[model samples]
Target: MYIHSTDVNRTLQSAISNLIGMYYNSTAAKPGIDYPEIPEWPHGYVPIPLHTVIRKTDFVRLLTFVLNAYELKKKNVAGKLMFPC
Candidate 1:
């Protein structure tokens, strides 16, 4: 099965968003963790900061590459698979 780069990017974005939501919700539900409170905007309007926007894309790319490499290792346990540098 082949996956396009755009599709992978979209999936990664969704996965990151879901993970963040889960983490935040879990923290809110737990009392022992001492999670910091997130400040609320007026009328539930939250703005994306410029720094987060810049760093998130790079973070997503790094995470996706690492996951792909891990999958490759799991599939090629015989050590016969060669990846181009």
Candidate 2:
């Protein structure tokens, strides 16, 4: 998978805001955090999971897990093709 780390901060802020909105109120007052509006996708919606096991509560960590899984799958495919003796 093509993972882009661009705008990691902005993306993280947006994700937190959306989570807060979904859990609490749209205009909920969450101190010690910046609540920015999430970017809209042009086509079909991309879903974000509400619950996470990793308690970092940020986008980069979550995205890293997803990207790593994709990379691992790609590597596995390459390994299988090369060792098909």
Candidate 3:
């Protein structure tokens, strides 16, 4: 599966928020250390499960693509700034 990290993170965040909301609504209890009090606001980094590990080749490819895209965007922005229309 060729999944982007940003997309995966977003989906995970949404699922976690939904699950937390469901748990709180069903039990009518405040969240503890296991869960954040505000599901919408992130407290820290979310840990990825071991089952959903990414391949080394895939990770390298993704990193290369991201870096190249960032560089291209930076150059484009700089060019536009240097030569305004």
Candidate 4:
């Protein structure tokens, strides 16, 4: 499967988690079963490659962020950004 994300670290990690959930094969998790023999590899762990464009070239994402910041500034809301767990 092909996986792609924004160059941002959070997006990269989120893509990796999705790949693990979607593609890992438990039946072939053992050494010499589906890949090179590596004792250290975790069971059912598949190395999935993530593709991303450089930040400067990721125009769509950059534009969205810039627009959001501009809107926030226009609103003039004085508050720290927050997320609830």
Against the reference, the lDDT scores of all candidates come to 0.49, 0.49, 0.50, 0.75
Our tally of clashes for model 3 stands at 0
Which candidate achieves the best TM-score against the true structure?
4
**Candidate 2 global Cα RMSD:** 12.4
Residue-by-residue lDDT tens digits, candidate 1, 19-74: 45544444235332343334442232222222223444566566777789888988
In model 4, pairs of residues that clash are: none
The collision pairs in model 3 are none
Model 3 local distance difference test score: 0.50
TM-scores of the candidates in the order shown: 0.31, 0.25, 0.26, 0.62
lDDT by residue (1-85, candidate 3, tens digit) is 2323333566557755655454444343335543466768454323333223354545655777778777776788546543222
Alpha-carbon lDDT of model 1: 0.49
User: Cα RMSD (Å) between model 3 and the true structure?
Assistant: 10.7
Q: Write the per-residue lDDT of candidate 2 for residues 1-85, one digit (tens) a residue.
A: 1222334567656765665455554344333343433455212233344333334565767677778777776788646543211
Which candidate number maximizes lDDT? 4
Q: What TM-score does prediction 3 earn?
A: 0.26
**Model 4, poorest ten-residue lDDT window?**
76-85
